[model samples]
Target: MGMHKDQRACRRVDCHDRPILSYGHMVRIAHVTDCYLPRTGGIETQVRALARHQAASGHEVSIITATPGVKRSGTEIVDGLAVTRITAKIPGDLPIHPRTRHHVAAALQENPVDVVHVHVGVISPFAWGAIRAAYQLKIPTVVTVHGIWGPLASPGYRLSELIAKWATWGITISAVSQVAAKTIERAVPTLGEVLVLPNGIDVQDWQLPVRQHDSSTLNLVTVMRLAPRKRTLPLLKIVKAAQERAGITMRIHLRLVGDGPERSRAESFVHQHGLKNLVSFTGRLDHAGIREIFAMSDVYVQPSVKESFGIAALEARAAGLPVIARSQTGTTQFIRDHQEGLLAQTDSGMASAIASLAADRALLAQLGEYNRSTAPEQSWPMVLARVDEAYARARHLD
Candidate 1:
């Protein structure tokens, strides 16, 4: 007699030839975040990368995000991952509404999932929902704290902290960075055991074509949102100082690619500093556009006083650009002093570093070479292995 499809016996051949069921068997992961594509930021990029990697590894992955506009609705497949954007009502002018949690919870109920990973921050309504759903279903949940919680000392922040403490696992993007990790741990003591997994980039995509050295112009680029906290004014000051102090008269061009609330302010500052010919602002470009910008540039600078993981810095290194970043935050962790790149102390110091590197082409090339060599360590393959191991520990499978 023929055996039923659902009632097939465990014969020797069937057991030996077929893949064995392990702990990671057909893992279905639901990534819940506040903002996603169509809205770009560090956390959005990181979650999207993780989802793509997970989907590529033969796991089913889906992302839930809040849709503010009428145009974005239903499911769409992006980069081999399924994305579902739900319609939310906005009572105020806020980009996201409180009802996002209800919509996300309903979606989770409709689609039973294995694990739910939450990216919690100031705007994480879906995170709140995902954690509550996971708790109700008794499924393992992981929370990645991507922002600084020190600014959130209000009642809302306290409530979010309570939810975070109950998470099965807490992951911080820059655990190796002492400043970032300590800041989070101080606010929420329960997050002391948080796993550290630095952000990563696709090294293959950033490979630049070898070009002959151009002696005429020194290309300087900074890829960041034109915001106040990023401190773009200081970067412009550095450019001015480089021109004045060096006296090299080498053509220095600054490419600023990103747009934000501070764009007008930055433009005014640039005008005030008479950097019209030297500085060019390319308002927010996609990854491919940014990659092209990186390829054309000789050096990358990040002057942000507040940075979590510095993914842009990693991308710059992958593209073989020598990076000079602020010495305060997560950027300092990735850049080794005088080895991979240089970390400047002040605006004057940053200007000095830029001037010194521009004067010496050989040193710039050497730093770029060293940075490219170190790119593999910050790739997604290495970062994901650490993430999987952390998930195993969170689920008590280890």
Candidate 2:
């Protein structure tokens, strides 16, 4: 279901009676996740950044993860942040452990914290275990859902509720976006509240050279892992459809950045569609390289309808480029239709949006200029405020 304006407006569920944390009080926070440093995916990166930001603000922060360290399992200082790894020697070093709850409980007992923040994807075993442990210890726990949990995952949550009765445990639940929160609400109706605590970005870092567009060629760029769930092939099809809609006179070049399991298949699709000349696949590029591309690109396109939060799309918008994203995604939190960029409800709609922008340079420039001048709401300061409030709310629950 699409998120209406009212639903999106309720980003933070209000807590009038709850006690707020005293200003200048030092807070000890423990962040639990399945992934961390040496494994830099979206969840891992967000958890790491959030923990570091908390630490920088004079709060004591530490991390407990299932991701292995150099040793099998140990504690180490990672970039000044203490990371406790509770991992076994599993194949591929997969972030999973049968005794995750036990280890997490031990870690929390070893160093008591004001709140335990657990990060989760659709089905994060380790994170769930950590939540269970925190609940058993009566520690104030907050869970941040970091992925799209559709109907397929509903049964698992139902089972979790049945087995653990977690919904009755008074833990504060949150999702990264409004759309995601609504879906999780539909899945687990018994939860007390599902807050919208979005991921944070350093908007200042994207302050690269202002984008100078060459209105001649329609240059589109998207940076994402080419996984099936990411809809890599569908992205290519949309780019092709947009080109066809724009007509042969308009030269369209799509820079497909990042690589994953679908890379080979997506490359095959591009070649089969006779789009080798129009689309170029660049496996992976660092932040600096992406900023350089942002300067040259006219628009950023993300074709994933299930994107919980399009961080790359946010980065592109931060770098002064108008973005094209699905209307149902968390990207909508930043990009409003016809404001920062156009939003599409379907693949054909996305194609139409691209073609419409290609035809109307005035609207395109206006959106781009608006994005370039305005800052996104997901800045560290604002996100930190929301997280602090979440912590306070969790403490109240405890």
Candidate 3:
């Protein structure tokens, strides 16, 4: 039939809606992803953190991924969780195991899990296969979509549903943000209303002592992979535009954190624009390194419009830095235009926001004060509570 059963299953579970949390026994969760540690990104990082938090919370958690191991495929205990790598020797080191369904099913059969929590991106064949395998085995499944599906991707998912009906029956679907969930609703309409499972962060880890920066020079920082879709080049352009708008009164120095294939292109843009003095690439840094940078930085800038959940932005906010990011991104969930930092609708608007912050130190200090004082609601405890709810829903569906 229809989604009648699914509707009943989700009748009480609204998106991010808190129900009376029933603290219960340990849940044996199996996180399935196409990628994991050593291969870092949003989904991989979130999955790892979620699994770790669940494990820390007395739940027995495991991970099944197609991302190749250091050598071959097998089970290994990573950070106390059993990680089963179902990998294939493929070119380009793609996280695509052709026999994902078989391996996933075999792993679960050998080691029973309460739920198969599949972390999916736009093109996660291994994750989709895990969903199918879980469905075939009549195991409870929850699919958390980690990316915003555009027009092409939405239709592509619908076509995939037509072929395999993966969005049907026992699957409980979710996304990282309302913006992302809306896209999934349009993409997998048959799944009905998708759930919102926001990403979590340990605030204490990112929380830095609030302090004022030197007014002579503005140290702007952004943490993101230098990818084309991430708009790294445009961020530099925005920095240049803001410098012009800010005039010679205040010097702006930008540090681009993280590295990707677009590093060379971004470097070329920096050189061509004569921004070598103002812009510097730190390559990639760990949490401690980023915190050290934030300790000395003035503002955190984000320019990606396709951001599903601005975890890095949240980290900067937690680090007590005023954030200036795109309005279209999921970062706007916590960051209001004048509240946390400034949200811009266009490139020029972002530049204007940066310039205004440079000119108006009081406003910047106010935003920074608000951010440091009022903590984000998307903390690990709240996120784990949401995870428990979603897992309960999936178990109920079975």
Residue-pair clashes per prediction, in order, are 0, 0, 0
Reference-based TM-score of each model:
0.83, 0.91, 0.91
| Residues 157-224 of candidate 2: C-alpha lDDT, one tens digit per residue | 65446323655787888889988887777766666357999998999999666655677688999999
Q: Per-residue lDDT of 196-264 in model 1, one digit per residue for the tens?
A: 766777888887766665666778888887777677777788888877766757877789998888888
Q: Return the candidate ranking by TM-score, descending.
A: 2, 3, 1
Error of 1 at 171 (Å): 9.3
Better model by lDDT, 1 or 2?
Answer: 2
Runs of candidate 2 exceeding 4 Å displacement: 1-24, 153-164
At residue 361, give the lDDT of candidate 1. Answer: 82
Q: On a 0 to 100 scale, what is the lDDT of residue 225 in model 3?
A: 89
Instruction: Kindly state the number of residue pairs that clash in model 3.
Output: 0
Report lDDT (Cα) of residue 46, candidate 1: 86
lDDT of 3 by residue, 1-398 (tens): 11123322543223113222233556567999999987888888999999999888887789999876664589987888889999888998798888888989899877766677988877788887888888877777788878774566564565346323655566778888888887767765566777889998999899888666689788899999889889988899899999999999899999999999999999998888899988999999998899999998989999998888889999999888889988888787678889999999999999999999999999988999998898998999998888788888875622
Worst 10 residues of 3 by lDDT: 12-21
Clashing pairs in 3: none
